[model samples]
Target: MKRKGKRKMLIAIIILLVVVVVGLGGALFFTAGERREARNLPIGHVNFKQLHDGTYLGKYEGGMYKWRANKVQVTVSSSKVTDIKLIEHTEKQPTGITDELFSRVIQSQSLQVDTISGATLTSKAYLKAIEEALEVAQE
Candidate 1:
């Protein structure tokens, strides 16, 4: 009787662990899929003239669960970034923090912005996605 009780408890523990693992995995899958989708989106091939003489819109996304989206519609002239506009800022994870960090990225086209200290991964992911978006819009 004692042996049976221990086996049942062990099985229950294993099942619970599996459920948690599966749930976390699903969240990651969705997050990654969203990011990949952004990369594939067609921006209509921004002409060099448009990039330098007109404006274009672009977007970025990064999050594990309850993602924070970033978008910047920028204007470039003479190979220099002139103005940037935020389309939708869904920074659901860290409130207003990511926006501030994004501001830093704009000031200097480097993710070495502020680091965000603890949310390092989130910051890097956001920056990378933005870089990808910029690459698309410029190309």
Candidate 2:
């Protein structure tokens, strides 16, 4: 009788441990999925033809993460993006990714451009800020 009771207790402990581990794993997986979705979100564009010629300020802070562009300033002139400025960003190192992204927006006149490879989160944040700024300029 004593041996049987010990065996049952041991089995119960093992089951509880397994349950805890699985729950933690599931939580981590879901969190990672959310981050991935945010990073891959499709960037939207503004109808430059309908946007009034002016400067606009936009800002975006990415999900719980530190890698993001805090603010951006965009200038539109005659239905074209004339300038893009990164007002603030949160990169630990100087990567020039923001500069490259700004140049692309100015040249293409659109936010539907490829993101920088290693700085995907920062690129997305910058694009989002540009979109927001342009949205304000819309007619």
Q: All models: lDDT?
A: 0.58, 0.80
Question: Which 10 consecutive positions of candidate 2 have the poorest summed lDDT?
Answer: 61-70
Q: Would you list the clashing residue pairs of candidate 1? A: none
Estimate the Cα RMSD of every predicted model relative to the unseen true structure: 6.9, 6.6
Off by over 4 Å in 1: 1-53, 61-66, 93-99
TM-score on alpha carbons, each prediction? 0.44, 0.69
lDDT by residue for model 1 over 46-137, one digit each (tens)? 23333334566665554443354666566556765555555566655464556676677656644345557766555555655555555655
Clashes of each: 0, 0
Candidate 2, 19-51: lDDT as tens digits: 999999998886785468667766786776787
State the lDDT at 25 in candidate 2: 94
